[model samples]
Target: MAFTLSIPRKRISASPGQIVTALIIALFLAVFLLIPTGTVIYTAFTEKGTGALTAINFIDFFNTELFRRSFFNSVYVAGMSVVWATVIALPLAVLTTRFDFRGSMIIQTLGFIPLIMPPFVGAVAMQLLFGRNGTVNLLLNDWFGFRIPFMEGLNGVIFVQSLHYFPFILINLSASLRNIDRSMEEAAQNLGSSGFRLFRRIVFPLAMPGYLAGASLVFVKVFDDLATPLLLNVKDMLAPQAYLRVTSVGLTDPMGYVIAVILIVVSIFAMWLSAVAMRGKDYSTVQRGGGGLTKRKLTKRESLVAYATVGFILLLVLSPHIGLLLLSFATVWSYSPLPDGYTVAHYTRVFGESSLYIKNTLIYVSLAGLIDVIVGSAIAYLVLRTKLIGRRWLDWAATSALAIPGVVLGIGYLRTFYNIPLPDGTPLATLWVMLVLALAIRRLPYALRACYAALQQVSISLEEAAENLGATKQRTIRRIVLPLMTGGLLAGFVTSFATAAVELSATLMLIQSNSDAPIAYGLYVFMQSPAGRGPGAALGVIAVILVGLCTFLSHYVIERRQKTLGAAK
Candidate 1:
């Protein structure tokens, strides 16, 4: 079917469908973020008796010792985490890139294990190994007649979060190191530069941009996260406030709403600054289309040390997985160390009735992926092409959400949309549109990056060529652009989908009573219960397998289809 090239300028009258789409997005933002939160803010100033304006809420937080302490702890712990993560990751990245080392492959791969786990899960695993009555505690007390205090308060939170988030710093710096022109390093070396001198002169300055990016990511992620703090029982964190408001009191708690608003402001500011500092220039320090990973042959002693370092890193990375795996097979559970002899009982329990969570996780993730890829692709196109109005603002708004943190958004939703009437006052509950919207928004950054990167590769001339050939606007996008973007779409889809499946922070805040909770929720619940060992471990294992399967299927289905089509053509 042929169509006319009458694409109207500025969409003189927005199409009914477009209007509906715009209304939906607007409605989501308004209802989920604006209205509910706005209500709380409005009520915050209102008199306690007359329910009118007052400074009570702000004064309450600023004045109260508890709230103030929590605020300080949030800062103290997150700051320490970022600093330590940088300190540890920098040397590792430097070693991997600069010096020849054995087992570099294993080290590089295991460094990223933390990235795959949800933030809270890391805390849970850490607790199992280091908390009171933990595996290490028991072993130390029995053998060494001493037990180390490694959990609770600022110290523990900072230690675990830093360990979990250091990969961002390491990978970023490693790439930067590999990118520096070999000749640059060679010239410095020939000019009496080695080790500390070489570092001070050439590598350090060149790697600054990458270091900054890694550091920025660490800071933003640690500052905004709620999962690790909540799991570790860190008092006075923003996420717990959100949880307390809805759980202990009700949606009417203005205190929670106030915290949510403050968090949003802080997050937005942090994100803006990070973007300016880290992304002032392009990120690819190493030239593209370059040779594969360069190997430097190490001396015998250095090679031995490198192997030792690899073993240490791998042990740290795999400890929790091993602990969880043992827990999964336990009949008695919680006894630690092989579960006092394994049984298939937990597997039976998990594979029996508790399997529902796996299904729920998969469904929620799939829908979120679709939303992310489609909406993100459209947003990317508008920002990159056609010079849409508020394109800059739109770009900022979309990316800025990443800064807002999942827990904050979850609070924003709880404060805004919790218990609101849905369709004919039917008493519609949680797992509604709001929950899904939170997931979509939380994961939108990945989709946006995928689309933005893909769009850059798709030159405007290709679209122009289609336009010149008399293709309709929609048709041109459908026939030309969408097909080329399957890789990015798939990548975005897998990321969003995986995160949604394992989501904890916002889900905990907003999930309703009697709702069919996702796997993360299931795991959290089990971890706290008498039956925690089997269910938590089983569910977590299921989640990992499903995420892997989703990635495989996405690659197999979408990319494979594209390939077959290309071959046929």
Candidate 2:
């Protein structure tokens, strides 16, 4: 007879634990991340006293001469930095991935040296080495009768940023080049495509995604950077303007919020453009034998040229580090090729008087890293292991922090929390704990990716086996899953800790007392005065060493774990 009407059953894939965990994460993201960000946007659009929606702020932003110049300067510096960074990176990537170059490992390893030290930390060092009266220029003037404006005005900012950030492009482009299918290159070669023509037509287009990704990152980083411009005394840029407006003009000023909004928009646009550029450009290929581009042997002339180019780039890249080490021990270094004299006194002064900065940094970053890995692991588990509703939003919320400049986050936190008083009557925003929270929020995405990758590598069958053996989800996660994810969690911790140790942007706004200042804030403070430069440089060297050691140890640990796991299997 007649068929009965039937309704589809809803899938109830998440357990109560998963649901509760998801709610907790959502609550944290909402209160800490979403509210602070929304507060900035709300302030940017609304009038100061009336609290009514208005476009006057944005109108003022576009109309003001200073704001207009800052806007253009930011764009120009970001664009040129990306260009120069690409110029520096492209040769290295092509040389290493395509040719059997000597000491390629050393070149690649040294390429990453800039990443450990923040651009701002090296800003003074760069100035000392490349300034008009500094080392390189002095030598050039003595020999060649001319000076390069390498550290003059906006040029200084661009130089420091390009050197610090080219590694991003280098890393991404090199990886992309290495992964390229050799078959396509062979096909191009069969069609008479060779050398530069082959690269332009075949290799680069296929690697465009990686280049775009890195370029976008560099653009966003340079655009959003506050300390580099400020340290270089090049304040005609959006980020420094935002920081100055808030710190000097006060948080109530509409200009800072406007700049913050512009920063966010530009960052999002860069990322979007990168994505759009990459759409429909997938060049992945399946092959029977070997993967990646085939390496070619460099001829005698080519080898000489490659080595010289790489050596020159490396020298320029490392000059800041060399200058820093020299500055740390110098009795006086002004307008000199080398220090007038050297001593361990600066390091002794740093340890004796500025030790609190180091201690605060250790505690704060340790807490922040711990928070990041815990939250990151939770989010990774919720998204990967369960079909929890709104789980993907958690990931999106955390990742959105990438687009928010640290200056904006600091402004948002100050605007949102300064009025809320603690039980002792101090404003909640002024507390040292807020510094740790900001660092955690800033570095959370990196930790989340590490945890997500680690979780992905843990076979689902292992979890299924645990569940089938009568273990609860929570029990299985703790006893089975977390043990396997240890490498990823540790990797995530070290990354968060290392990066957070040097983060000064958001903390600059939150730090209320010298006693509570972390290493980065302390470095900024020391670098501000002429007399403190030696101690500041010493502190920077310490930071570089700390980050470098952590990175090396993380790599070693992850590799050892992989080997052990492979052997057990």
Task: Write the residue-wise lDDT of candidate 2 on 456-559 in tens digits.
Answer: 98999998999999998889899999999999999999999999999988988889999999999989999999899999999999999999988887788789
Global lDDT of model 1: 0.69
- Report the error of model 2 at residue 22, Å: 1.4
Structure candidate 1, residue pairs in collision: 36-416, 45-53, 45-54, 46-52, 46-53, 47-52, 179-286
TM-score of 1: 0.85
What TM-score do all the candidates reach, one by one? 0.85, 0.97
lDDT over C-alpha atoms for residue 316 of model 2 = 90
Runs off by more than 4 Å, candidate 2: 1-5, 288-290
Candidate 1, residues 329-416, lDDT tens digits: the string is 7676353633567777677777786777766666677787888888778767766775434445545656655656566666656544
Q: What is the C-alpha RMSD of each candidate to the true structure, in Å?
A: 5.8, 1.5
Model 1, residue 90: displacement in angstroms?
Answer: 2.7
Residue 125's lDDT within candidate 2 is 93
